[model samples]
Target: MIVLVVTACPAGLRGDLTKWLLEVTPGVFVGTPSARIRDLLWDRTVALCNDGRALLVYSSNSEQGMEFRTHRHSWVPTDFDGITLMMRKHPPSEAKRRKGWSKARRQRAAYEAR
Candidate 1:
């Protein structure tokens, strides 16, 4: 099975808490206040939708921010419009050190360096 996990905290607590939550699973945590809500919704055991105000944490619809659970592996954009997927990419194995990333984390250092 597949899951879209998300972690969210207040603006002041986003940094450390976001990282901690991600450590719990292969999910993403959104730091921005606006996006945090959306991320949390996605990270739940259920699906979510981006309504531009709050994220529909659990839904039966297949619209924006919707996570489809199938046997297929696919890629979903982190951000569409004002909504961002609170998802992270796992770090490559030791053999992939040359890739210069421990895992697929959009850390502040990495995001700011870009």
Candidate 2:
């Protein structure tokens, strides 16, 4: 089985993906298409996503029994000792990091200033 999740992508792309997969939700598709078709769909999604993000997950023979691919997203797919992993890439700038930091960080900084 294959499952695809798209976020902030064009409506047309979602419609196109629906042709080959069932859209269980607004931007989520699920199906069991052939590998070639799955790859093609992923390519098309990547091309149409532009600045949006997408994730494709499918059954696999790996240790996890599933594999996933990501495009134009902050979270990245990584390989660790034959295991597939997902990790968030660091923000590009300190300003962005500060914007996302938890309130605990601010509290710690305030305590340190005392």
The best candidate in terms of lDDT: 2
List runs of model 2 lying over 4 Å from the truth.
95-114
TM-score per candidate, in order? 0.17, 0.79
Model 2, span 1-114: residue lDDT tens: 999999999999998998999999999999999999999999999999988999999998878999989998788989999888999998667764444568998899999999
Residue 104 in model 2: lDDT: 92
Least accurate 10 contiguous residues by lDDT in model 1: 47-56
Tell me the deviation in Å of residue 6 in model 1: 26
lDDT of 1 at 5: 34
lDDT of 1: 0.37
